[model samples]
Target: MRNNIAEMEFLYSQESIATQFSRDKFHQFLQEDMIFPLKGVRKKYSKNEIIIPEGEVTNEIYFIESGNVAATKDGENVINFYAENEIIGLTNLLLDSHSEYAFQVISNELFVTKYDKESIIEKVINTQEGYFYHYVHMQNQVSQMIEKEQLLRLPSEQRISLALLILGTKFGEETNDQDLIGFPKSISKGMIGQYTNLNPNTITNVLQKLQEEEIIYPARRAFYVDIFKLEIKLDQVLKK
Candidate 1:
């Protein structure tokens, strides 16, 4: 299937080329190539829309604007996500190949941007300026990778807490009722397992214990952490 740029937006843009090259002569070069990808922007997809299959030869790239999309090796195993302000299909663009993971929408409001390889290689990468542009862009990726590695090294429980805490930190705010309220999101046992070494049954038990004592709220695939109580508990756990 063919895809265009408007269909995606950056889900995890550690650094945007636009913002990064704003003051340089590189803006025009990047702009021309960007226009080449969006020759046709398709309507957005609802959740579960299969944007790209795991192993297909495609020249398209996407950028997520809103919502979230997760990539997986099998349909069942999630690899990563394109949340907001990040590029999708980047692996393919850089490697001149296809994805080994399946991408599906996880949020209802996701939007994206798409582009082609020829434009990228020619208009964006062939020139001296193009070389510099890709250099700065790739450097940020190294940093993002390191951050993810540091995160993955933490225990599963900590990883879950960290993801939630990060999500909460940006979207969450303190309440006078002694709770931090942010995006009303959910966490599931299986997801916790993927992020850490926890098993489903153990995840269930820990979640239940937390919920029973009002430490968290586990609802099916969605779970909530009580900030005030959680912080106190985390403090004690960290000390140990």
Candidate 2:
């Protein structure tokens, strides 16, 4: 049981890196392909704009050119986040179901290439590379959901630590210190609470403990993490 738990946690922690690589390759294909430019329309969204409302029928696919968007449950709980080079709406498009969450632009400005569902099916999905991208995308999405569910089942401290580590790996920028990584200010403590389904007070307390331990520290515009220290601390927590 101990070995199983440890192995599961290791795979969950590594999912972000795997997802990043898949997203990059998928985006690269879209960028190089001529079908996208011919069949898709480019659009820009301002911050806080709703791209898709909850329960709405998804009719189009969106490819992010720049900026980020968040998928929220009932306009509050952030279920997921999509950044530049990521594609949204494919799941809903393929499933032919209503959107489970509201997607909103989180960056100051978001640029995306939008493709109607039919166009995507007939133009992109029919192609060999496109089908492969879709398969990999769906696989990554499933892995993320499974990992997130497992992380949420952990104790608050471990949950928060692993959540930050995943987010840091996906969206963070490397700092001068090879061991440190910096996540954008958009990944606030409140966002962390929402993502983990934890109370605000609990999030605050756990974050404070992490700070005191020097595993993570806050900057004016970002959260800086000592990746090595954080992994060690998380391993200790898991053993306990």
Candidate 3:
């Protein structure tokens, strides 16, 4: 049983590492040398600013130059959070659908390069690197959607834990403690509940339990996470 647990940990770590590498590659493709030539307008957005409102038709694609954004449905349910180097609006444009969620700036400030749908499509078809980046971006989007679906099916505690893990992996910064990673405090309990489709009370309870366990703790304007401990907790839950 111990061996099986170890194996699962190894598998999860390997998958996490690979996913990180893919993310790095995607960002690498977004460098100035690649994007500067594109006919895109660089724009700055203030916190809480709406980039695309729900039900609007998305005729543009946005590449984050800096900062964070969130996609929320009905102005409440958080569908996803996007950080630097990530692309938004592509999914809706590709699917020929209206925006189902509002994309809003969650950071103090956001800088993004926006390109019209036709211009981006033309670039994708005309440039080898653009085509590759587009492919990778689409792949990552699908993977994220699938992961979110899987987490939502988990029991409340596990679902919230996994959600935090995902957010930490994406937005966390290295801390003085080697075992702890810190993510923005802007990601509140309410946002976590919305992200995981759980009640606010449930989010509060689970977070309190995690804090008690020392798996996650609050920092100054950030939350410090012990991912190793959290993964062990998840493994233990799975064993049950």
Candidate 4:
């Protein structure tokens, strides 16, 4: 693979260097020997493409540059969805084992920077910035895992409510009227079921209830959470 030095920082950029240095200065620093690994490539995938097959040994880690990728376990249950600027396969790199879940491109297309796992680990320890970036990444990963565990312990109705809240927080965009926090686009109920490990029937019922209560607006293609109502419900749950 031809080295794409400048793009490598996207692999684990908690804070982009572009904000700190001029473009030319940033490139100049990267050009120095061993500052960042040059063993990476930029790649793209079409929608529904399998980026990383479950059980496959992943020698490389991917940093998403754009679009969305869904990580799923058992071919249907979603572990999580990753969007632009998030690194995939970091946990796999740390474990040094075959991938526990499959990663698939869910949007029309996906762009990612791929790097060798070993090279990344080496550089991460040698550089303070890299160390801090990886540290934050790991913390975020652990927090998400803990959140998921908490979700799993809730009753299905509360669990679904919390799942929608999580998705809305991650992918929501403010509406023109500022009353709704809608996702970039609609997501299917089946996908929601996959994420929450709830049955299709249960998901449909729960969503219908939420819609009737005006806590959310659900549609066949996608749904939007009522930010105000959602916050109230979340607070209620927290106080329980």
Best by TM-score: 2
Q: Is candidate 2 or candidate 4 better by lDDT?
A: 2
* Model 4 C-alpha lDDT per residue in residues 149-205, reported as the tens digit of each score: 898888889888888888777877777746578754634677778888899999989
Displacement of residue 111 (Cα, Å) in model 3 is 1.2
The order of the candidates by TM-score, greatest first, is 2, 3, 4, 1
- Candidate lDDT values, in order: 0.57, 0.78, 0.78, 0.74
lDDT of 1 at 42: 36
- The C-alpha local distance difference test score for the whole of candidate 2 amounts to 0.78
TM-score of 1: 0.65
Which residue ranges in model 1 land beyond 4 Å of their true spot? 1-29, 32-42, 92-96, 127-133, 166-189, 209-240
**RMSD each, Å:** 8.1, 7.0, 8.0, 7.0
Which of candidates 2 and 4 reaches a greater TM-score?
2
| Model 3: how far residue 197 lies from native, Å | 0.9
- 177-229, model 2: which lDDT tens digit per residue? 98899875666778888999999999989978989999888888666988899
TM-scores, one per candidate: 0.65, 0.83, 0.82, 0.80
User: Candidate 2 versus the native: TM-score?
Assistant: 0.83
Query: After TM-score superposition, what is the CA distance of residue 150 in candidate 3 from its true location, in Å?
Result: 0.8
> Model 1: per-residue lDDT, tens digit, 84-124?
55666654345447677778876655676566656666654
Residue range with the least summed lDDT across 10 consecutive positions in model 3: 1-10
**Model 2 misplaced stretches (Cα beyond 4 Å):** 1-37, 94-96
Residue 235 displacement (Å), model 1: 7.1
